[model samples]
Target: MIEYLIGIAFCLSSALTVLILLLPSQYDPATKDKPSVQILVLGDIGRSPRMQYHALSIAKHGGEVVIIGYKESDPHPDVVSNPKITIIPLRPHPAILQTSNKLLFTIYGPLKVLFQIAYLWKCLAYTAPPSRWLLVQNPPSIPTLAVASISCFLRQTRLVIDWHNFGYSILALKLGQNHPLVKLSIWYEKTFCKSTSAHLCVTDAMGLVLKNDFALQAPILPLHDRPASHFHPITNPQERNEFLNGFPETESVRSSLAAGTLRVLVSSTSWTPDEDFSILIDALVQYSELAAAQPELPEILAVITGKGPQKKMYLEKIAALEVAGQLQKVTVRTAWLTVPDYARLLASASLGVSLHTSSSGVDLPMKVVDMFGAGLPVVGWNRFEAWSELVTEGVNGLGFGSATELTERLIELFGDDKKLETLRVGAQKESTRRWDDEWDPIVGKLLGLT
Candidate 1:
């Protein structure tokens, strides 16, 4: 149970946490000195590639960055070790380390938010200077907005709220869509979002909802999350060998590589219920049946990487599936890799399959973006506006509505090398094409406060 609590905090690298910036302005002498751009993410700094970009963006603009986040272990310097960036990690609160039980998260989520926000507030009160703009990640532990809004008002700084979907939507996934708490969350988000200086979201789908449904007055900026340029494919054999060596099981499967029968499908998941990995597992079951019928099909391996509370449950289920069968052509492997190793695996894999359907039905999955960055095509499910925006049906990748359809799509993706290769090429071409230009200017405008 203790370990599970720790994993909950570990896997929640993307959610929670925040930053309250004290930017220099005309009112204080601090304005004449160095104007620092501090970033606060209640989650792990290394866990969030988006915030890493934010830090780099600040440094690129000749501003210092101070990140406030929590990590269970030693902080990974790869994200915020920049000379211009500083980190002030908040100690992990007991609430953050709660297990996967929704009841516990429901009870502790607010506590975790309050704990970290208060800790950061105390930390910043003495160490931070008055600043121009303060940005907070949206759907943050509900109370984050009200507290941050108060701080912004007091500091006379423009507050920028980056919406990733209502936090209630995630709660809905854990609880239920119709729960009164979920409905109340929707009301809470709508009420607070209108108080921000400018609202930013990951997709136009969310922006539309904010404007049309929530009736928010703040300017909605759709800033698509992107991977850094370092996230790319590898050509060097030595580097490839070293990365593969990280996984002994994968390294031992050289037979498939030599026989040309091994087709590797890689997926990075947090193993949460929101991801609905059971759909992928079920689809694989159907595919396995087809492979048994067609002996000419190539051998396949599905690699799912990540750690979370659900890992043990799914592993047991997967074990049962494997044993209840004859010799299978496709095998499933689960791995927990570091950030660098995960990126390398993504780059080397033949295909990237994502089971993530945004919990908010509005936020796009970062895993899909990372896959595209690694020049790997993606297959996933999303019925929301994300279908057209992120996965363009037949263009970049395919999205499925059911397990049966997804099975057919996966078979098609893996059946031919040419089809998969074409997607790989398309992904690479898209990666070379930057979406950064669209949103980078908005960051400058928001951060450039008078």
Candidate 2:
């Protein structure tokens, strides 16, 4: 069945390639002054920050950007207000595709890909303005890669793929590596990705993998994720208090904070399968036990923010722990905040926790980058090889392998004020390195903006 769909996609792409060769090139007088670039994302535009950053950077360099993606959440104000940037939202997947039943998923997966291909083609080839380049995100690589490649060929646009992680590797997490679906995804990604004009990856290790493993012929540059100027430390006590007070969720912990008996620990998650919230929950449970026995230990208010599938399940687990009288000195609260508010939360918090253990092991988590941007030191999962690149062992942040290790790191940081301060100072130093500093030189040249 998957083979049938693949054959159909191939036929469509071949037909489009021949048709485009026969058609006259499109020239718009209005886009003559600005070099147009289309940023394609198969996921939500607001949630995909790296692509948004790419759009922003392109616009800054006087390139007109058309962002094509699902607009489920509101994007950053800067992106919304940019005159040179235009957003073309794609049709969302059907509600039935959101089902958890394996049978339903297996049946509808191909249908979802077909729907995505048609819509993506329409948006890329017809609706969006003709552009010099089309930059796309990977990991939804199946139909997205095929559609973008076809459309770029049809429109006479350069195809640039920004590799976050291997899409096949992510799929392998749900289906075993030996699964036929996983194999198909691997073949699809490798086949289409080879045709990209240029490649931008999240980590240098990823770039190496592309060259060594995939044998990609394109110029691959590792453009690491860095926070925008909007993400900064909230130094003013009044500003911090005001932001925290604005949220009703933080009300219960305010008095404890004022009394200097509680500390705020912030963790931002998509509540996805890749991030194991169980580790965090276990660590928090252990912390609660320790804090109950030691009166001098600080009470914790853990603020976990983001929307995803596993959120309700984890929330229920946390609730059950509370009901059973297990979590006494620790409180866990979940929230979905605006971009600005999220930055404020990170800045105001005493520490940050990252649950992301990369699916591909070569990619670094952008959440940790955001946390560092807000001058909050992170206790990230350290199993991946790429973790060391962004997080230094004793400098900016600490790392943990298991729940026990995480709990121990938490105890050490929270118990010793001086050690936490040193890490915070390191994180503040990291905050100074903004996105544009790295983006302009490499990415600008790739897009012919430099």
Candidate 3:
């Protein structure tokens, strides 16, 4: 009995040892024979759509991309299906690292060695094994960048920065153009850009900002998300019903519109102080006469999508305006929509709305691309510095100046069915020719699958 027990113990111990050896390791895999490039993607991997897309892009590029992301955002369903993608969660709270950021902010402000300290704290917590190569996807959080920089130094790895959002621009917007923090962020951007192997950006606008604003010579890789393609328009009742759930009272509106009520659909981030949704809302109020006179006149419904930090404030404003009856008139889709679903939803609508005030002129939202893909006519409020050039008035879409002009333009378009059809066709052509055309190549090149 004693001999048998000893034999079993030995077998169990060997099995346990093998299991330990087979566990996942952070060490760079053996790449002596293969062309191995390890990329360490960091920063807002949870929030930034571009970063989310970057995972797919890197995997498609055929590189060994290891993503270090925040644990708060939960699993990205689309990314989970890709086998080549490896996600490492950096847990965010109840830990010294998270608290360390507060300390750094207090000591040095946003740009002080504070980010570096927080990053170091993250490094200590995430210590597992090191890789031979690393790439950072525009480390926005100073601490995260510090951690990434530290990892590269320790591992003797290459650091690649993808600047999707210009940090200085954001700081300038938040703290004023001449704010000290803005200047510091600008300095950091200049310092980092000169050293990185490649600086990836999404638009020529950003490239100009880097070259002119910062004087950097890094190669700019203009990355665009996959554009809308092959979306069948909403024609069936069941399809319309699905869209109605998102649009609120779509069925009644659809019936009324078919009988000659001009139906205009609008969607935006929210009725934020900056968005100028009030401009559109006020326009509708001014055009109440038009709605009444042409009982068959166009009924305008603005669909508000996305929840923000100021959602409650906006909701309160909506209620205070007594536009709750207009709730059916202007629906708010509070839940997040996947990129493809968002595209389809936009396609079902007649128009998409985008407006920016002086404070947010530089924001070229992802929705603009979706609107183009869906071939929906866009009514953009030009506040200067906007990509409003994309919407040429009376060509593919219309550009409005104020609420009064916007209301007049909508009424004009509502009466002209032939013009609407012409614009719709032009919008579709422009969208497919320009925006959606780059998808296969962009995705292909990024994945190295091309």
Candidate 4:
């Protein structure tokens, strides 16, 4: 009887040990073993605000997120602090892959794509299952989905694609739009993209491309970029002063040169080949001539933010003109800021200006959205139909067709403080619409909740 009792006790102890090993010890009651999502972006997250925002959106819902993207500055405080989120940064891309030189890009593009696929396969293998999702940021869509679809099938993981613009269109800029390889890429993207569980696009025009051109099924969501929760039109007087004082370089210039009456014209550019920063440069130059002739227009200081391949070239051009004293009372300065600094700069601006026209002719420039959220009236370059939703001519803001027209608009705005004030009020009112609210329904459906 004693021996039988001993045998029963031993078996029971072994079974309990095995069960404990199988259960995950890290599950939070708030999350309740929600599946982990891995977000993949083939480019720098610093440049891809939408990807970072998407990761934050998932984390806010009490699910774990693992961001797999190229290295960038630390994300928001909330994103960095969340225990449910893990960031895994990849090394930067080789120059050959990023080159605009068509011959080198064509030679090495496929090789780079293949390498990322192999690396992703290894990462996805260890991510435990039972409702795993892979949210792939598309634009480099074809190569990504071609490999990602196979991994999703093997792992039985669901796939979600957030399409920003067609990768082929960008490649066409380098390799010629009609190149045989560009055509092949378009076909390849459409074919593999259909395999994803759901597709999210940036605009309605882009959704049409997916629906009509690619023939992707339902659950196609259009989610536009809005200002983050941290961004609002800061109304407190003391807070406004402190924010401007934070920028030592700009502060000293404002205090010494303009004696605290400095009128700031802030514009941000990615400095990409597609953008013509020269237009804003020219507009500011023209405005300087007007400022000098009148001697009544507040001394203008232009602060342009962001950096890219073409930045240095434009900086040199702007600097030479300043040195020669051709721009009169207007001065141009360049800043490469972290996300927080950029937000502060936007808050301090008297007026917002953006030189971007859509590279794809379908997507909206998110920079304008950021400006509008700060209650800064924009004088944007009129270029696309999608912008009509944001920039209403003579209502909230103004639009111009060219640098010559933009210069005229700037002259009109600064010449009348009352008119500028009225437009500023309009921009603040526009901020309340809240497009961010549209996110949950589509995301919920993708998560299989609704």
Candidate 5:
């Protein structure tokens, strides 16, 4: 009887030991496992404010973000700063492959996507799984995208894509709509949108376009590409004077620069005829005498910053209008800004301008958001839903149908100090409220770290 009892005890102990070994000791059922999220931001790192905002938000949220970026003229902050972020630089993919990728991205895209699949396979095998993965809209590289898809499958990870711009629409505009490239881009967008967990767009209009055209069930999140505050406002009277001194004007012009002058600032990387900056210039001219009538009119300066395709032509236009004397008063600064510096410089301006001639509705411009953040109002065309949703005419800012209307409105806004102050305060309030309520929440949700 004693021997049998000993044998039963030994067997029970062995069984309990085996069960303990099978269970994961490291796993605690009650604790929420911190998901390992690895995001690959593949794009022109500096050019798009959306990319910057997305990457930074993810990093700030405590995710491991890696950037595979291409260098343009400016160096991006996410590439250099943020301890959580790592950047992998590569040579610009050949334009031919880019073209071919667009071609294959459609019906046959998956066929060519094998290269990306193989690349992703290797990446996943090395990195191991259960990590969340993503690829933001970028150079439109089919291979990299393929890799993302394959990596997600192999690793059993969730995949998300932030499609900032409609590459197909851009191609159709730049190239003909009937162009093969346009057709292919549309096709790739469809497939990619269908495959991803979510596709983030910059505007509601764009999201509508995707859903209506592709019939994609993928969830769409509207995320405008804009920098977080880049520069501190130069409110100090002394600092403003020093900056003005750097771009000195004659006493006549200096007197033209008055304190209350509704200063209009226009800056961009490049200006094509499509931008139609002449509208702003003409408006400045119309309000010039009126603004001059006020003590602030002398301070009413129109500063056009950055080099663009229209640089020479616009310079000629400035000269012809005799705004050249005003151009000296107008600060045409070169495009040299860290993201933060650019934001600060923009905040100092009274108004943000989105003067695109193309009728294709306003994709939410980063300038608008930056303007919002800085408490500056936007003077934009009224065709865009985004403009309507954000700006209330004569409230937050004014949107117009034509150059004449835009100019007339500018005259009214700048002429009245009470109205201008009202708009400025409203703009700052609206910007802060929108950032906290709308954009930041969306960013938090997208990161899945909310």
Candidate 6:
């Protein structure tokens, strides 16, 4: 069945390639004053920050950008208000895909992909302005990579793939690595990815993997994730308090914070399989026990923010732990905050924790970058090789191998104000390095915007 589907996809792609070549050019002579670049994302535009950043950066460098993606949530205000940036929202998948039984996912999944392929092809080839370049996000690489590559080929546009992680590796988390679907996804990614004009990866390790393993011929640049300008420390006590009080969840903890009896710990998650929230839960339980025994240790207000599939499960576990008296000293609160509010929450926090253990060991967590930008020292899962690229052992942040190790690190930092202060200083220094400074030179040159 998989083989049959692959054959059909190949035939359809070949036909589309021929059709696109025969179509009239989309280039408009009137709009030639500035270069046009299309930023393509298969996911929600607002949720996908890196792609939005790309659009913003291109616009900043005198390039007109047409961002094509699902507009599920409101994107950054700057992106919306920018004159050079135009967003073309794709129609969402059928509601039946969401409402259907899990047993029928196999039937629905391919149908959805087919819909996406047709819609995406129309947007890229016909709907959006003719572009000099098309920058696309990976991990929804299935049809996007193939479709974008072919469209770029036919239109003579440079196809630049921004690799976050291997789509196959992520699929393997659900279906084991040896599964037929996973194998097919691997083949699809490798086959289409090689056709891209250039590559921009999140980590150096990822670049190495692409070069050594995938044997990609294109020039691969490791464009590490950096925090945007909005993510900065709120140094003023009054400003921090005002922002904290604005949120109903943080309002209850204000008295404790004012009394100097509580320490705020922030964690951002997508509640995905790659991030093991169990480790955090267990660590919090241990910390609760330690705080109970050691009176000097401050109570913890753990603010975990983000929307995801596993959120309800984790929330239930936290509630159960609290009821069973396993989390007396730790208060685990989950929230879904706007981007600006999230940054402020991180800045106001005493420390940040990251549960992301990368699906592809080469990819780095953007959450850590955001935390560093907000001047909060992070305690991250250090099992992956790419963790070292973003986190230094004792410099800006700490890395933990297990729940016990995370618990120890948490206690050590909260117990000693001097140690935490030193790390915070390092984190603050990291915040000075913004995204535009790095992006403009390398990416600008790649897109010919410079």
Model 2 agreement with the true structure over 267-380: per-residue lDDT tens digits: 989988899999999999999999999888899989998888889999999999999988899989888888988999999888999999999999988999999899988899
Q: Per-prediction TM-score, please?
A: 0.85, 0.94, 0.73, 0.86, 0.71, 0.92
Considering TM-score, which of the candidate structures 2 and 3 is the better prediction for this target? 2
* Residue 265 shift from truth in candidate 6, angstroms: 0.8
- Clash counts for all predictions: 9, 0, 10, 0, 12, 0
Taking all chains together, the TM-score of candidate 6 against the true structure is: 0.92
lDDT of 4 by residue, 125-209 (tens): 4443323788889877755777678767755667999887777777676677889998988888878888888888888888877
Model 5 off-target regions past 4 Å? 1-43, 74-79, 93-131, 138-157, 224-264, 269-274, 281-300, 306-335, 356-362, 434-443
Instruction: Tell me the deviation in Å of residue 309 in model 6.
Output: 0.8
Which window of 10 residues has the lowest lDDT sum in candidate 1? 18-27
RMSD of each predicted structure: 9.7, 4.7, 10.2, 9.3, 11.5, 4.9
User: In TM-score terms, which candidate is top?
Assistant: 2
Candidate 5 lDDT by residue in tens digits, 1-450: 999999999999999999666432221223333334554544456665566555666666666665555556565655467786665544443343333244354535444355444544444445333355555563353555566665565455567776645556555655568987668766776666566777777677767876887687868777655436453344464655445444432234444345443364544534754467777777666655555455444344555555455677777776766744543323332344556655655666656677754334535555666667767766777775566655687787877777788767666666566776777777777654443345567757765667
Candidate closer to the true structure by lDDT (higher is better), 1 or 5: 1
Estimate, for each residue in 1-450, the C-alpha lDDT of model 6 and write its tens digit.
Answer: 999999999999999999767663655536677678999999989888888899989898888999999998889999999999999999998877652344476677788889999899889988886888889999888799999988887777888999999999997887678978889998899899987779999999999999998999999999999999999987787887677677678676778777888888999898989999999999999999989999999999999988877888999999999899999998888888888888899998889999998889999888899999998898899998888889887889999989999999999999999999899989999999899987988898887777
lDDT string for model 1 (1-450, tens) is 999998998767535332323332222526544456556566666666676677777666666667666664434455545787777776777745575677776777667767766776654444555556666776564666776666666667567777766788887887799988789888877777777778888888888988899888878888887766667866464666556555665765766765667777888887777788888888888888898888767767788887666888998998998899832776888877666667788887777888877876778888888888778788888676665677666666877878898888878888876787777777876666443564468776667522
Cα deviation in Å at residue 388, candidate 3? Answer: 5.3
lDDT of 6 at 135: 93
Candidate 5 minimal-lDDT segment of 10 residues:
23-32
Candidate 1, pairs of clashing residues: 17-42, 18-42, 19-40, 22-130, 22-131, 23-130, 23-131, 23-132, 24-131
Angstrom error of the Cα, residue 9, model 4: value is 52
Task: Give the higher-TM-score candidate: 2 or 4.
Answer: 2
For model 2, the stretches where C-alpha displacement exceeds 4 angstroms are 1-31
